[model samples]
Target chain A: MSGSLQTLSDFLQCLIVGLRLGSVYALVALGYTMVYGIIRLINFAHGDFIMVGGYTLFFTIPAMLAVNDKLPIWLAVIVAIAVCALVGVTVELVAYRPVRKKGTNMTALITAIAMSLFLENLAQAIPAIGPNYKIMRRMFSNKAVLNFLNISLDWTTLLTILIGASVMIGLQLFVKKTKLGRAMRAVSEDKQASVLVGINVNRTIIITFAIGSGLAAVAALMYFAQYSTIMTTSGTMLGLKAFVAAVLGGIGIIPGAMLGGLVIGLVESFTTGYISSSLADAFVFLILIIVLIIKPAGILGKNVGEKV
Target chain B: MMNKNTKLKGYLVNTVALAVLLMAFLILNANFKTPFYSVVFIPSLWQISYLIILAASLNLVLGFLGQLSLGHCGFMAIGAYTAALLSLYFERAGIFTDKKAPVFIVSILVSLLAGGLLAAIVGIIVGIPALRLKGDYLAIITLGFGMIICNVINNLPFAGMEGLSKGSAAASLYKTGLGFGNTLKTKYAWVAIVITILCLAAMFMFIRSRFGRAIESIRDDEIAASASGINVSLYKVGTFVYSAFFAGIAGGLFACCNSSLSTASFAFTNGSILNSTFIVVMVVVGGMGSLTGSMLSAVLMFLLNYVIKNVIKASGMPLFVQNLFKYPMLVYAIVLIIVIMFKPKGILGTREFSLVNTIEYIKGKLGKKAVKEGGSK
Candidate 1:
C-alpha cells in the first residue's frame, strides 16, 4: 500500500510540474491565438519574435548585472519586457505591414518567415551578441526552492507560472475592458467594417502584434529564469509547441489558449517522466492530430459552416 | 533578314552551352589540383544540384498543387539514412559474392524504393488532414508533423547512444556490416554524387512533361482543375510522394558523403538543415512555376553561401560574427525578404525560354528597325 501511494504521489508531483510548464505554453499560445483570431493567418515567426524578446532580456540582464550585481529582479524584468515590446512593434511595421497593405496573405506568411529567419541569423552573426554571452552560465545555475503539499518545487518554476498567469489575466482585462481591446475585436471580425467605423485598422494590428509579442517576451524571460540557456535556435521548437497549444485550445479564442496550454504541459511532463523522453514530442503531435480530427476548429473554436 | 541566321545561332548557342558544361566538369575533375576546387567548389555544385531537385519537387506540390509542407527535410533524412544503411551493408557483405548477384545496384534501388514508399505513406496521412483544412491551418499541422518526425528520428535508439545520437549510430551501423572505418573508402563519394545528379536529371525531365502541366493547373486553380476532371487528391498525394522520394534520396546521399548521420543534421534548430528551406526561397526568387528558375536559384544560393563562408574566413572577422557566417540560413532569409519586396513574382515569373518566344522577340526588334528605315525614307 505504501509503495502504491508513493507511486501515486510521484505521479501527482509530475502533474504539478506539467501545469507550471503548461502555463508558459499557454502564455505563448495566447499570442498565437490573438493574432490568428484577427487575421486568420498563423504568424509563423511569432515564436522567433519571442526569441527576440528572450534575447533582449539576455543582453539587458547582463548589463544590469554589470552595473550592480544586486539590482532588483523587478527592474531587470521590466527592462526585458520593454525591449521585447519594441522588437515586436518593429517586426510588425517592417515585415508585416507591407504585405498586409498589398492584400496578399501568402506574401505575409513568407515575409514573416523571412523576418524570423533574419533575426535568428542576425543574432548568430552579431559579434558581441553571439554564443559567448556567458551570462546564461552565471544567472541560470542558481535555483530557488519552494514546497507545497509535501512536494518540493524550484523557485524559478513557481515564479514562471506566477508571471505567466498574471499576464494572461492582465491581457484578459485589457481585451474585455479597454477601448483598444474593443477596437481590436472589431478589426478581427471585419477589417473594412471596423475601418468604416473610424477605427485605425493598421494601428490596431500594430497594437495586437505588440501585445502578443510582449507576452511572448514575458514567456521568454520566464523561460530563461527557469533554465538560463539561450541559443540562436532555441525558439524554433518552443515556438512550434506554443503554436500547437494555441491550436489545441481553439486558436483565436483567449481562455481556450490557456486551457490547451495547460493540457499540453501536463501531457508533456507526465510522458517525459513516466514514459520515454523520446516519445514526448511524438505523443504531443499524436494528441494534436486527434484533436484536429475531432474538432477541426478546436475545443473553444466556433465551427463556422463552409460558405461554399 | 536575320531570322534564319538567328535561329541557326540559337541552336549553335544551345550546343555550345552543353559542350562547355561538360568541359568544365571534366577539367575540374581531371586537371584542377586546387584543394579549394575539391573541398568547396565540387561540394557546392553537388549541394546546388540537391537543392534544385528538392525545390523543384516541392514546387510541384506547393506551387502547382497548392499544398504547404514543413516536413520536407524529414523525407530527405529518411532517404539519406536508408541509403547510408544500404551502402554500408553491401560494402560489408563484399562487392563480389559467391551467392546471389552484386548488391551495390540492388542496394541503391532498394533505398530509393524505400524512400519513395515511406514518403508516400506519410504523405497520404498528411493529405487526409490537409484535404480538410486550407491555408494557415494546413501549414501549422504540417509544421507540427515535421517537428514530430525530426524529434522521433533524433531520439531513436540507434548506434548505442542516448538522446538522439546520429553520428554514433551511423558509425556503429556502418561498422556492424563493413568491419569498421569502411566509410572512409574514397570511391563511394564519387558514386553517390553521380547517382544524385542522374536522379536530379530524371526529375527535371519529369517536371517538363505533360503530366507536369496537369499538376501546375491544380496549383493555379484546384477547383477549375477538378472541374476539368483532374483528381485533386490524387495529384496532391502524387506530388507529395514524388517530392519526398527525392528528399529521401538526398538524405541517403548525405549520409554516404558525410560517412555518418546525426539528429543534428535532420532537425530545424541546426542552421544547415534550415538552409534546406532555402531551396524554396530560391524557387520563388528564380521564378515560381519555372523549373529553370528553380535550377538557377539553387546554384545562386549555393554560390552565395560559398562566398559568405569564404569571405568571412579570409577577412579576419571577429569570432562571433565569423561563427554566424558559417550559418547560411540567415543569408537565405535576407535574400528571400529582399527578393520578395523588389520582385515579388521572382525572376522568371512563370515565363520560359523556347524557340517561339525567342523568334517573336527578334521579329519585334526587326519590326521596330523597319519602321525607323521607313521614316527615314
Candidate 2:
C-alpha cells in the first residue's frame, strides 16, 4: 500500500509536468484553431513556425550573450516572442495570402504542407543550424525550482503555465473587446459576408496569423526554456500534440483550446507516471479518437448544421 | 505491332539519353572523385523507384478516389515487419541455407500480399467510420488514427513479448518455428526496388480497369456519381484498401532496405514526413490522376535530392551544406508550400499521356470542317 502511495505521489508530480506542458500545447493550439476558424484551412506549417521561433531564440540569445552572459531572462524571452510573431505574420502573407485569395480549399492545404517543407529545409540549410545544435547547456535544464510539500516543480514549468494562462486570458479579452478581434470574429463567421460588411479579410487574416504565431513564439520560448537543447524536429511532435489539444477543447473555440491543452498535458503526465512513459502518447491519442467520435464539433465547439 | 517510325524514334532517344548520362557519370566519377555517381546514381535509382510506387499508390486515393490519409506509414510499418520476419525466418529455418531462396523475388511477393491484406483490413475499419465525414473532418480522423497507430506501436511490447527490445540479443519466443541458426543478411536494396516496381505495375493495371473509372467518377463528384448509381461507401473503401495495400508493400520494402525496424523510423519523423511529402509532391507536380505524371515527378524528386546531396558535398561547401541533406523535411515543407502557391493542380492535372488524344488533335487540325460538323450536332 505504501509502495502504491509512493507511485501515486510520483504520478501527481507528473501531473504538474503535464499541466505545464499542456500550457505550451494550448498556446500553440490557439494559433492552429484561430487560423482554422477564419480560413478553414489547417496550417500545417504552424509547427515549423514554432521551430523558426525556437531557432530565432537560439541565435538571438547568443548575440545577447556576446554583449554579456547575464542577459535578463525576461527580456530575452520577450524579444524571442516578438520575432516569432513577425515570422508568423510573414508566413501568412507570403504563403497563405495568395492561396486565400483564390479561395480553393485544396490549394491552401497543399500550400500549407509545401510551406512547412520549405521552412524545414531552409532551417536545415542555414549555417550553424542543422539536425542537432546543443545550444549552450545550462544548469537549469532539468533543475526544479519549487516544491509543494513533496511535489517538486521547475521554474520553466511554472513559467509555461503562467504564460499559457495569461495568453488565453489575453486572447479572450482581445476577441471580445478589441476592434480587430471583432473583425477577426466577423471574418471567421464568413469571409465573404464580412467583406460585404466592410471588413478587410486580408488584414484580418494577417492579424490572425500574427496572434497565432505570437502564441507559438511564447510556446517556443517555454519549450526551449524547459529542455534547453532544441532540435530541428522538436516542433513536429509538440505541434501534433497541440493540434490534439485544440481538437480536444473544441477546435476554434478560444477557451476550448486552453482547456484542451491542459487536459492533454495532465493525461500524458499521469499516464507516463502511473503506468509507463511509453503509454502516455497512446493514451492521449485514444482520448482524441474517443472525443472525436463522440463530439466531432469538439468539447467547446458549436455544432453548425452541415451544409447542404 | 510496333510502328517503325515511332519505334525508331524511341530507340534513338533512349540511346542518346543513356549515352549522355553515362558520359556525365563517368566524367563526374573521374573528377574530385566526384562521389557524385557513386552516391547519386545508385541511390537515385532506388529512391526514385520507391517514390514512384509510393506517389502512384497515394494518387489512387487522393487523386482518383478523392480520399486523404495520414496513417499511411502505419500500413507501411506492418508490411515491412512482416517481410522482415518472413525472410529472416525462412533463412534461419535452413529453407534457403544450402542455396539461398531467391530472397528478393519471393520475399517481395510475400510482402506485397501481406501489405495488401493488412492494409485492406485497416482500410475497411477506418473507411467505415469515415464514410459520413468529408474533407477536413475526414483528414483529422485519419490524422488521429495515424498518431494513435504510431504511439501504440512505439509503446507496445514488440509483438506482445515484454523486455524484448528491438535488436536485443535475447532469444524471442515468437521467432518462427525455425531453430536459431546462422544466417546471411545481405543488403535488401534490389529486393526493395524490384518489389516497388512490381507493385507499381500491378497498381497501374488495377487502376486501368473498370474500377479505376468508377474511382475517377467518385473523385470528380461523389454525389453525381452516386446519383448515377455508384455505391459511394463501397468505392471509398475499395480505393482506400488499394492505396493502403501498396503503402503496406512499400513499408515492407522499407524494412528490407533499412535492415532494421524501430517505431521511430516509421513515426512521423522528418524522414517519413519527407517520404510522404515527396509522394504528395510527386502526385501534385506530376498531375493529379495521371500515372505517368506521378512516375515522372517521383523521378524528378529523387534527382533533386541527389543533386542537393552531392552537388552540395562535391562543391566543398561548408559543413552546413551537408547538414541540409540531413534535414530534408524543411526542404519538403518548402516545396509543398511553393507548389501549392504556384501550381496547385500539379503538372498533369487529371490528364494522361495518350497518343490517341494527340492524334485526335492532329486530325481535327487537318479536318477543321469535319471537327466542326461533329460538334454542331
Candidate topping TM-score:
1
Give chain A TM for each model in order: 0.92, 0.92
Q: Which residue pairs does candidate 1 place in steric collision?
A: A144-A155, B64-B219, B76-B247, B79-B248, B79-B252, B80-B251, B80-B252, B154-B164, B166-B261, B166-B262
**Native-referenced Cα lDDT, model 1:** 0.69
Query: Per-residue lDDT of B75-143 in model 2, one digit per residue for the tens?
Result: 665665565566556656665553244644564466457756776687777777765566666666676
Task: Please tell me how candidate 2 rates in CAPRI terms.
Answer: acceptable
Q: lDDT by residue for model 1 over A31-134, one digit each (tens)?
A: 88888888776776877866777777767776887899887554565776677677878877886776676735656667777887888888877776675433
- The 10 consecutive residues of candidate 2 chain A with the worst lDDT sum are A133-142
Q: Can you give the DockQ of every candidate in the order shown?
A: 0.49, 0.44
Return the top candidate by lDDT. 2
